[model samples]
Target: MSERVMPGRADGLITLDAADALWVDLTADSAVPTASAAFTCSPAHARAGYVLLGSRVVATVKASGGQWSVLETEVRRAAAELNAVRMDRQDLVRIGPFRGAPKKERNETTLLRWRQRITRELQELGESERAVRREGGGPSHLAGIDWRRILVERTRDRTARTWWLPRAVVRLLDVAEHTETRWVQAARTCQENTAVPEPPSHPRQARDAGGRQTTSPKGPGASLRPYNGELEGQLYSVLSGKPGTSRRVAGWVCAVCRTAPATVLDHCHEHGYVRAPVCQSCNTLERPDHLYSNDIRVANHYARLFDTDTDDWLRHWHRCPGCRARTTLPLPHLAAWTAHIACRSLRPTHHAPRGRKPCGVLRVSWTGSQNAPRSCLLTVAVDFCPSGEHRVLARVPYREAVERFRIWLAETAPAVAAAAGPDRLDGLPAQFRPVIADTSGEGLALF
Candidate 1:
């Protein structure tokens, strides 16, 4: 902590025996704090300090549970304990490491200031002490103080200065002083053969000397300037995840879609070349669709077509909703036709075994001979059913064959339509028909 000094007395001091006895006897204020504590010049450990803040010492210990108050008892006991053994370092499991070696000062100005602090604390606490009480007409403990303040006050001269403990209390903290020592050796790896900055001989000179520091501006032994990520005259190749640039800035964008424009000096995580940087959108989310699916190809082709037409389409041939695709003419057909020949194509057949007369005129034909004109003739005698109505019909091919033939007809119909452009569709020049069916007697009805 910041040190304070009084002319005749010191502040807090502790004893190892007292600390040991603390847990067993909570009444004893010697418990080592499991938190943080700072020590300055105090009456309890006068020898441990130079002369209050002027030429005094500074020490600290960390507590186990952020118990800062424990630091007071711990440091006091440490100073007293170390002084007894003359040991430089120690290990106190609960308390942190500590150093007794005082930081030598250049002038007495610091010490003078410490003295002023002690004088102020005394002024404030002096009048309040008389009315202090432990439980009944006595004084209460501070963090860990007890009403038995005489021995403590007498040793540290609390009356004259604000004595918190005795100098001998340092021994109580010694057990952990060195063992908790923080030994840090900061090793830097400078592969680029860069210069390092040197430590300041006089702190103020380094700060206020018009930028003229005691340190060498260029030296192999000095510390490297923080770099501030500043790569002068060049980019400070920065590379984290995703696309990045060489140095911190000023690199060309990588033509390679996803690779970085540049690599970080010491680290590179990506698999591709870190050549140049890319724009923010490209790096973060925007990416090209690279797969070639049929939809994609179609879309691409459609896009190309759109460049000229602005719209491209396909024809959907209409079909009977009930029968799916059954139709004489598809909606997509440009032209279609049917050839109607007048004829009586069949006669009724009989159930021969049931005394039924039968003269079924089925259209029967045969090829006459090879190497000769075939007589593939078809005959249908005038026919009558039991109801006696004359009907004419021709047996076309099978269903599939009829469908295929229909498609063929639709295909060739356009050409036929073009030629028929020179003539009428019915060869008689037709008009819309009023369709009627023979449903009356004699199978003939007037419409």
Candidate 2:
């Protein structure tokens, strides 16, 4: 009998009749044949096949060779242009539905016209109301805004509720135009124009609302008089040189204390201005007359002490014990850490004397990043001692303090942690952790 060989890793031989039987067999136990021969299906076809299995295909696009790339490029470019137009129109309708017509003329009639115009534009761009209404993917930042509010309201009835862009449909119009959401754009624009003073080309005395020239006897205005021209010119130059600085400064999220959006533009009351913005808490905590108030050195100082990142003024900069003495010294890590733990334990008195000072003393001081932009000064001190008097001990720059703490913890924490018992892990905040045995001599491995 003649033997037939099956391709690939198959049993030795089979008769033609047996091969035909194998091909015809559809039993669950039968092995399916596999081959890497030329596949007639292209990647596009395979993708299409998978997509066809789905309920809906958003867009059915066909492209061949170089035309595909060109089409893609054109689509993207056209899309971007359309998005810009849509957003600008949306903003226009949002802020002024009357399209700069007199305020008295703005009413439901004008709003209907504006909506019709937008709808026509969308249709011309080959987009339908259904497409515009479809929810696109992204995070929504405005918590207070209800976009569904009327786009235009009658001037007389504006007191109860005013007009806003139609939210349900318009918000879904273009999700990508979100740099300045319509909800906050007006507030942001107002803040930018008014929050920071614009220097006049020529030094004219700043006037109050009554047209009387305002005087600042003890404030920034006092220093502005003598060098008004020079200062004003410099201020203009600085502000203009860095165009983004104003926006960044105004939009600053407080780096100090990790607080929410910073409202105050921090500056040197004496030197005029610095670029960084600080939260209300950090800005108000220190006396304005203090040396570090306008200096980045102050920011660096506190960051080092707490092993935190520094980009602005520290809230506790005034807490430096050596500020009065004008000299600071290094505090041992062991003593500083002990004092930290002790300070954490002390609670505030409910009805204590109103003017009583807290029980704490500065023991250590350090300065890091000197002569550099990032230069920082750090001071560590003990608070809540048994004796009424708080004594100054040592001070080191924040960087050194961090290293000292890390080293001390690494060296001493293992034994201490072992002594903490199994209960050491319980009732502790996520940040507080017992020392591990594998601590390095270089520093505390964990924060």
lDDT string, candidate 2, 1-447, tens digits: 113223321112222232223222311121211111101111112111111000011111212221110111222232233233222222222323323232223232221222334333333433254245434322111111112222344354643322335322233322211211221343244446665532121012333223333211121111211111211112222553565654444344444444233434433222222324444334433222122322221221232344432112222221122210111112222223423432334423223477644454334333433222146554544435555344333344445544454444334344322332334333223341222211111111110
Q: What local lDDT score does residue 138 receive in model 2, on the 0 to 100 scale?
A: 20
C-alpha local distance difference test of each model: 0.23, 0.28
RMSD of each: 41.5, 27.6
* TM accuracy, model 2: 0.21
**Full-model lDDT, candidate 1:** 0.23
Query: In TM-score terms, which candidate is top?
Result: 2
lDDT of 1 by residue, 132-173 (tens): 631234222211222124212222354232233222222222
Reference-based lDDT, residue 379, model 2: 50
Ten contiguous residues with the weakest lDDT in model 2: 49-58
Candidate 1 Cα misplacement greater than 4 A, ranges: 1-119, 126-130, 133-447
Clashing residue pair totals per candidate (backbone < 3 A) = 60, 21
Off by over 4 Å in 2: 1-244, 251-260, 264-278, 282-358, 363-402, 405-447
